[model samples]
Target chain A: MDADVKQHQMKLIYDRYVRYLFIASACLMTIIILAIIIFVGQQGLRTFTEVSVSEFFFTTKWDPMEGQYGAASFIVGSLYVTLLAILLGAPLGLAGAVFMAKIAPSWLREIMRPATDLYVAIPSVVYGFVGLTIVVPFIRTQFNVSSGFGLLAAGFILAIMILPTIISISEDALRSVPRPLEEASLALGATRWQTIWKVLLPAALPGILTSIILAMARAIGETMAVQMVIGNTPQLAKSLFMPTSTLPSEIVVEMGNTPYGSAWGDSLFLMALVLLLISLGMILIIRRIAQRRLA
Target chain B: MSTGSRLISPKIQDKIATGIMWLAGMVIMGILVTFLFYMLYKGVPVLSWEFITGEPSDIRAGGGVGPQLFNSFYILTLSLLFSIPLAVGAGIYLAEYAGNNRLTDMIRLSTESLATVPSIVLGLFGMIIFVNMLGMGFSIIGGALTLMLLNLPVLVRVTEESIRTVPVHYREASLALGATKWQTIYRVVLPNALPGIMTGLTLTAGRALGETAILIFTAGTTVSRQLPDFDVTAAGETLAVHMWYVMAIGLVPDRIDIANGIGALLIITILIFNLMFTIPGKLLQRKMGSSRH
Candidate 1:
């Protein structure tokens, strides 16, 4: 009886410790996020020793060779591409979501859903390569621009890259709307389109909005694809077709050339910090929306 | 009829809307299909046994991608190895242990935020923490450690989701039988969740296999001279990074061909990897008789 009791005691103690182990594992996630922000922030903040915050955030003069470090162009360029991608991609994603949720036969949904999943699996580098070979040239020739590697090209690539996120999320949102609501609308002499737009859409708007903001966050932070197609020019673009660099693009383009602690390197780290903060802010925004939804 | 519907009846509008949605689906599918075909068309001719198995050359015309291919799998395996336990542990806490409270929500949000951190930023973090601070120095271990960050959020999410899908009755039955909570989770819940977790892991692995930015700085865009070099300290350039290097800065005369071949190989491997899990996953589900389908 004592031996059996000992085995049971060990099991009980082991179980308790394992629960603490799980809790610690979760805590580690919070630690990683804080560590990234601190380290990236620490390195990036050093750039201000040489360049003023106003000049860094508000002006476009970025000649690191001469110690000037204004970064307005990269910041603006990131916005232009991210917004343009949403403008291009979100409507199609919504339509695709609706089609999958309310229109497509189950067989079709089965096929397309996996195919869409494959979209996320494809590498950003491959998308960039395809954009370089096909979209950039097509843009250059079709628009008669000097070059096609610019906000337009980058936006086009990012739109495709973000489709899976938008579609999957919004589809779930739409699917979650009660079927009785749709049925009531249809039974009240409303067309299917009316039911989707007036009843289903209103119900799912919060989730759809969440998906859009999340997609925006993704579009803003996409690096290799944007870098390859945006031409990595530090100057602001004069036209959609003109070349300009976003934060991620410029960082990748110049990171290899700069040494570890030089002003140039710190400035690049600062740019990465900016990207990180923007994404963190996005998480807060998403959390707000989720809370409002629950309330 | 409403005022707006006077000119265009609801019936006609529904028809048009249906057509438009169908057109949207068609267009997206068309683009995806065209892109895949274009990649395969340009890449398949460059692929060969030699291309798959030979050493990469510095400036030569016909350098193979053998090293990069090996590094992709090796780094992927190592990253998954490092991340799966911690992520699964956290996931179990979220799904089975923690109350549905703000604390759990905050924990979940932190994991999701990790997902939102750009790969480029993560690359720099890895570079700072592993490459410089720890002095792992452009090694597979350094790259794998950084890439593990990318893997963690996805694994935790899938794990929580998979665990949640295991019916509540399964747990209740185990507890009713006087089984300890840990035993119930380990023996019943995890086994039922295994198929889902496996599928999710394969998907995450597919995504990781083609990751470039995280590996670029952390892994140091160069490879060991020896074939299949297993030194954890050796530079671990992967297939995706190799393709990017081939285009961006490579001076190799056959850089374009190399890029194409690598691109095609990446897509093929991802397809195989995803399918690998799916078939076995279904079989496992059937063997378990868990009623998932």
Candidate 2:
């Protein structure tokens, strides 16, 4: 009886320790996330109040050297590049996913899926290098320009970089399409392609959109590759061929030795904040959709 | 042929649609091929034993990525060491022990959400916490710890799924044979789950090897090309970071080649790591399928 009591006590201690560890670790993840938001928010807000609101918000000129900084141009650049990336990347990625999930032979699917997966494993830095050497030269020659680096070039590179993400996510969505749905479409004498389009595609639309939005989030926050190829000019451009700057790239360029003013720091912080908000919004939406589907 | 016969559309329309599909497939394949070809063309010339082993001399002129290479290996080794055991253990608890607890569900939700968090935010978080609050400064150790945080959720999710897939019968039989719970988990459950764990490790290692933004915030952008003094924490640049430094900051022609060499090396390393996961899983799956047949 005494031994049984001792064993029960020992089990209680073990249970308590494990439970506490789990709780502590889980709480730590939330704490880390909160701390980041607060720091970025605080620093980002400093720029808004310190700088003239008009100068920071309305003006297109971003001469950090002359200190007449406005993020209008950089913001435009990021948006333009991201839009271009989505335009080019989404179709290719979705098609590839569909082809793999629906049409490819077993051996082809086996080879292609891993091949696509390998692209994800390839570091962004390598992608940057490829863009610098191959894409840059191709753009220069094709456009007959001195500088091959521009918003369009950067967008193309980003599209390639993000392709794996879109492909994988959309593939999952496509796979979730009920087999019965496809079979029913086929029994109605629809062609394979038609069945895919009329039946599977509609069913998979939300998941595909979710993946595309996630890819967009990636493009918006992307720094190293976009920075490497975007020519680092903070000017609004009418054409896709023109040089550009992005918020993340600007933050990376300026944050190291930012002038000791809250305005500049806050502006950078605000950009981070915008990015944070975008990602948070995306996650919330994805979570809702996921919960609904899973539930 | 049956597909063609069933498609009783105007022959021209069917032909056109089929043609467009074929064209689209060709274009995508072309892209994949061209990307590979261009990378090899630009990146291969610089790949050499001397280049791989040499150190960065003048930031602008020329040197090998010896330091960055060491940093990559070091960070990969250390972060995996710290993260895998904890992640796998947590996964085991969730998959086997939790059994529908609300807390476990919360953990699952959080980890999935965590996977979607943009890496840059993770970088910013690491900077404030590790670099400033913890006073680790820009060092190898700092980067490794930061990486551990980024990788943990992914490891947990992958490990959990893989562990859950292990047959329940194995666990029940082990218990029925009078094995202790711990022994059952270790002997019966883990062995069956080894392939999946390795698969998860491969993916995690690939991400670790290729990770950049978080490292940039925590690990300073200094590339020391000499032989790595593993004893010192504050000394090296990772291969990915080295590529960025060479292009954006270093401003040297020779450094560009070295960077290219390192870029190629990094891609090859990751590709190999990816294969490690894929090939084994495939072999195992095939074996299982054929046995069932």
Candidate 3:
């Protein structure tokens, strides 16, 4: 009895120590996040020391070799492609979500579910390769454009990339809209279309919006696929078919050439910071939507 | 005419709406099929024993990606090695120890923020710390360390989710039988959660295998001369990165063929990874699931 008591005491001490270990591992995530923000901000802010903040966000010229560091074009280009991608992706993704959640037979749903997951698994670099080989040429010849690499090509590729994100989350949202509400609508003599649009869509609006915002975040930060097709020119897009550059793509294109401490390299870091901030802001918006739904 | 159309029936509208839904599904699937076929068609013709193991040429025609192919698995292995334990520990904490407290809230926020930080931004972070500050230069070690950041949030989220699926009764019974909290988790909870966790791991590995941007800067886009180089400090270009490099800046005459081959190889590997999870995941679920209850 005395030895057993001693062994139990030892076990209790070990358990307490293990709990601390788990807590430390969890805290490490916070420390790493803080490190990223601080380090990226420190390197990125060095660009403003040479080029004023206003010039970086307002001017179009990006000739870093000649000391011109204006980044208005890249910022604007990112905004345009993101919006275009959302416009094309959201409707189609939402339609698919509704079909999977409400309309599709169970067997078809099972098949398409993995199909969508596999779509997400397709590497972005492969998407870029496809854009370069097929989409760029097809756009050029079909549209009678001088070049096919521009906002349109990048936006089209991104729309496809973000489809799975929107579809999966929105499907979950639609599926969770209590069956009683659907039955009530049907009992009132509403058609299936009216029940979905008027009853289900409004009830699940917050969740659907969250998915859209997340998809928008993904589209904005997409670097490899956009870099491959966006033509990497610093000009503001004259038309959908004209060559342009986004913040992420511009950074990828130039980071290899510039030395790490040079203003050119720092400017790329700043672009990355801008992308980081935008995505973080979207996350906050998503949390707000979730809180509203809970309340 | 509009009033007459409305008078025609709600039945017609529902049918039309249903038709539109079917069309949307068809369009999405159509795009997926076309893209897959296009990649495989352009790539499969370029694969061979020579291309798989031959040395890459600088400006010559018939270069292969032997070094890059090796480094991809090498770095991926190192990253999974680094991330899995830390993430699992953190995940167990969230699922088992964390209560509704300020510390737990902060941890959750940090994980979400880490996930949202774009991969390119993560690349720069890795390059800043590992390559420039730490003096590793562009190397396999730097790349693997950065890739761990990409993997951590994903692994933690999955592990937490899988652990949550284990019934609370098992934990209560273990504790009632004099097992400590850690023992209950180690011997009972983890075993029950293994199937889902394994599936999550398989998916994470697939994503890491094809990851390019993070490796591009940290690994420095240049492969070492030695095949199967064990040196962690050597340059580690991956197949995905190789495809991008060939398209963007490679001077080799057979650049197109090389890119196609790498693309096809990556796709084939994705298919295999898919099989690895779905089959074993189902069998394990059937075997262990009933026992867990």
Listed in order, each prediction's TM-score against the native is: 0.98, 0.89, 0.98
- List candidate 2 stretches off by more than 4 Å: A1-16, A19-23, A52-58, A63-69, A259-263, A291-295, B1-26, B97-106, B175-185, B224-226, B285-293
Whose DockQ is greatest here?
Answer: 1
The C-alpha RMSD in Å for every predicted model, in order, reads 1.5, 3.7, 1.6
Q: Tell me the tens digit of each residue's lDDT in model 1 across A162-208.
A: 99999999999999999999999999999999999999999999999
Q: After best superposition, candidate 1 residue B59: deviation in angstroms?
A: 1.5
Tens digit of lDDT per residue, candidate 3, span B95-116?
9999999999999989988987
In model 2, the Cα lDDT at residue A205 comes to 84
Residue pairs in clash, model 2: A44-A269, A44-A270, A47-A266, B56-B225, B60-B252
User: A1-295, model 3: which lDDT tens digit per residue?
Assistant: 9999999999999999999998999999999999998999999999999999999999999999999989999999999999999999999999999999999999989888878878878999998999999899999999999889999999999999999999999999999999999999999999899899889999999999999999999899999999999999999887999899999999889999999899999999999989989988998899899999999
Give me the runs in candidate 3 sitting further than 4 Å from their true place: B1-8, B290-293
Location of the lowest summed lDDT over 10 successive residues in candidate 1 chain A:
A108-117
Native contacts kept, each candidate = 0.72, 0.29, 0.71
- The best-first sequence of candidates by TM-score reads 1, 3, 2
lDDT of each: 0.92, 0.76, 0.92
